[model samples]
Target: MERSYPRDPEWEAMPDVGLEVWPHSPPDTAAYGEARAQALQAPEVEKPFSENLANEALDIPRSQERALSYRVSALMASLARLNHCDDEPTQADMRLIQEQRMLVAMQLAGSPSLQQRLTNPAWVADCWSDALASLGAIGVRVENLPEDCPWDQDALLDGPQPNGRNR
Candidate 1:
């Protein structure tokens, strides 16, 4: 003997109030393929005038170009010193080198022109040579200084002091 399950009479008597469902058909793949093929066959178009002008605006000015060149030179010199030094670098020296590297990295991230300059091997070699020469000159002067000589801070001060007194 099979037992029959009982259903709620009130629920069965209520009208079926359900949303209307629409049947979905597959998209027209043939039409999409035709359109894509047509787009691929289309001729290349030149950039608009305003777009060209915007690109030109991205170029660095001569003054700013020179300033970036100098900063890059200084960074290169600092790196060279860090690599070539016989004695271990002090904490302050390491900090300075790290700062210079970070500064150059940030600058390069912002400017495409500077990034382009770095791509030229000849320019890079020239900058490296200049850095080495500058470092050599500074080293020579530093080596010639007397170790026991006292630093006269007052003599180095040319203008009025922070305490309102004229030096």
Candidate 2:
């Protein structure tokens, strides 16, 4: 008796192969080389500092600016809620605050002017003072702040001075 093996019906139904032919001729090597050489010979134009700065500034669309403003408003709301609560802030609340701060920082960092402004300690302090004031104006009591809060407690309570300094 002969031994039998299982055969795949689908494979058996496939047509037998014949010689393969390319649909099109191979690319012309000389033309490719000439094009590549021309590309290599092209001069690289470097933009001036002012033009580059202007381009960078223009890269951020107005929609993105609106989004950043919206995010900042949301952060302020979160800060108000956290500050108003008498109970200690939960871990999630702290995380949200940190995340919002990081996002705002990242957005501000995108602008060269903002980046330069951030380097000024006084400007940063004033920004914090202004934020706290805004929260206070909205009836959000600026009390029970986290220990790691950036603004000075006394300054925040007294309100910002004319010189943007906490009295």
Candidate 3:
């Protein structure tokens, strides 16, 4: 059966981006959402109390061990999948991803959280900002950057991306 998105009729939106004190409107006007969800569950059977307690009680360490086991198992499964794959990312693809990381890092570095650390030479070098700068050079202009991007996000305002975003 095709799944349908259940409706919420009263989700009114606000025009501005600032913080909100309270929900302007509640979404569930009729309160039928919970009713619909509960109707989908099977009715409880007349099972024994011991059987019910056994199912309800969990071995916490065993549960945690199972989670950790699955996590490592997933990592192993991913490694196997990568091993079986015929095509792998090329140098150019890796370079493109690295460029995007640099762009995103540049965005992150200029955020208010990093304001105090931005101008520090150590912060710049730690992110390999200069090495990436001299490597590829994407030439986007200052005004054309992302809306929230800093004026001089990385390197200089005048220089190109490592490959030449400026030129």
lDDT to native, each model: 0.48, 0.49, 0.34
Best by TM-score: 1
lDDT of 2 by residue, 41-60 (tens): 44553346445544443444
List runs of model 2 lying over 4 Å from the truth. Answer: 1-61, 114-167
Model 3, 5-103: lDDT tens digits are 866555445455432522343232112222223333325633464344434332322343333333322322222222223446455644544554454
lDDT, residue 163, model 3? 28
Question: Which residue pairs of candidate 2 clash?
Answer: none
For each of the candidates, give the backbone clash count: 0, 0, 11
Error of 1 at 120 (Å): 0.5
Question: What digit string (tens of lDDT, one per residue) describes model 1 on residues 58-125?
Answer: 33234345555666667666644554455566677766656765665565555434555665666565
What lDDT score is found at residue 43 in candidate 1?
54
Evaluate model 1: give its lDDT: 0.48
Number of the candidate with higher TM-score, 2 or 3 = 2
Best by lDDT: 2
Give per-model TM-scores. Answer: 0.44, 0.35, 0.23
